[model samples]
Target: MIGRITNQQQLVSAQRNVQTSRALLSQLQEQAATGRAVTKPSDDPSATASIMRVHAQQRATEQYGTNISDGTAWLATVDDALSSSEDILRKVRDLTLRGANEGTMTPATRSAIAGELEGLKSDLLEKANTTYLGRTVFAGSSSAGTAFAATPAPYTFTGAAGATVQRRINDSETVRVDVDGAAAFGTGTGSVFALIDNIVTDLTAGTDLSARIGQLDTHVSALTTQHGVVGTRYSRLQQAAQSNLTQSTALEAQRAGLEDVDPAKAIIDLKSQEVTYQTALGVTARALQPTLLSYLQ
Candidate 1:
């Protein structure tokens, strides 16, 4: 009776051990195949919460990268517009200087120069109305139509009076995406249209326009200064874009390390789990079989 009781207890213990090993093998196989420690909250509540947090962080990083890309594209368009404006302004300034010199130019020659100046003014106005992807770059927040409204008086800015749209590149950094049309093309005395009009009127009337030549020089100088400022801002934006790209790449790699499984590691773990499961099955099968007590002694 004592021997039988001992054998029964050993059988029960072996059965419990076999059940535990089977459960462990199942879990190990799932982990190796799916490469996830927890398939559901029931598997591991704490690990599920951790996975959720990492996913949220990865989404935020992706959004920030998108913002950087969009901001960079807008800044590039602005830079191109500014460059074209600078070239046009230089041409207008040269024409004014040539017209101002009375000794070499006849009245007819001055009139011809005035006509060319008028054409350039129209070109400048067209450039000021530059659009990117169907939206005006200088239109402030109102990009529904043209940035500068055209009347008989000349081109005039009709967009929002003081709305400046800014793009945030980082936590503490922001840049104005649209250059105010009034500020870039001028509002009162610094107005390009006014300067062109004054020169045209003076030349047509055959008056001493030499004094107005100085005004043109001043306008050109102011435009040059504005161009430099825009150019510098563009350069900074380019650098910021590059830095954001690098940061995004690093973040992607980090996220992959946290979430993506290495195939080699998974395969090795799968093989190990299979071996362990097979061994457990063999042992359990042998223990469950009838012993020599079944045969007559």
Candidate 2:
């Protein structure tokens, strides 16, 4: 069965086509206005998920970078303390060697050596109790204000055995940032402070100081070993920091690729869509124009 086409039906169809074209043009204009390719989840759900994943990776990389920085500071502090203590010990060793010569030393000379040794002990005590941000670096994870106490006759190391402070630089790597106080400067009566006190006493009593030189050598060796370990860890943290920076940069690029739109392409698409919508308007207007023949039909 053939049905006659009506003017009302033709007008309705032309209006619908124009409405659809206008909607497409509006969408393109919005895409150009906002630089983001996927402003809403519905814009590109798959890309949205990928971008979220990239963001998570970026956050993790950033945190790792922070850990590397903190570890570097801790190692540097430990290195400085060890180096200073070593230098002080070397000076004390030289003084001890001079005082051990019984033939050249007068009473005044012996008293002067003892006084100087006492002064060096005070300085060494300060280095032994070195603190970083109100916490002793040698004490590992211990919260004590200082690592060593020199008030009593025999000094004591307050750090706990096997305790350590650590920082995580990445998913697979963790580094220890603090030194062992008892190991670096011996604990209890065998501590470096006690050794210094004994040397000062012997110098005052006119006893030869040659025997104490061997004990002094032991303290110097311990500081040197700990300093080397700190330097090695510092280098490791520096490498980890570089890797974290590279990872962060790559993740940012990936995130931008997934979420951001190229401005030039968006503008070009918007212009093309606008032209298409304008042409549809022109065609719909022409088709809907009233005619004398149409009224007779």
lDDT of 1 by residue, 189-279 (tens): 4577777888888877777777876776676676567667667777777877787777767766665665556767767866777777778
lDDT of 2 at 36: 76
RMSD of 2: 2.9
Count backbone clashes in candidate 2: 0
lDDT of 2 by residue, 51-134 (tens): 889888888899999889988888888888888999999999998998898899888998888888889888988888888777
Clashes of 1: 0
Cα RMSD for predicted model 1:
3.8
Of candidate 2, the 10-residue stretch with the lowest lDDT total is 151-160
Off by over 4 Å in 2: 1-34, 285-297
| TM-score, cand. 2 | 0.87
Structure candidate 2, residue pairs in collision: none
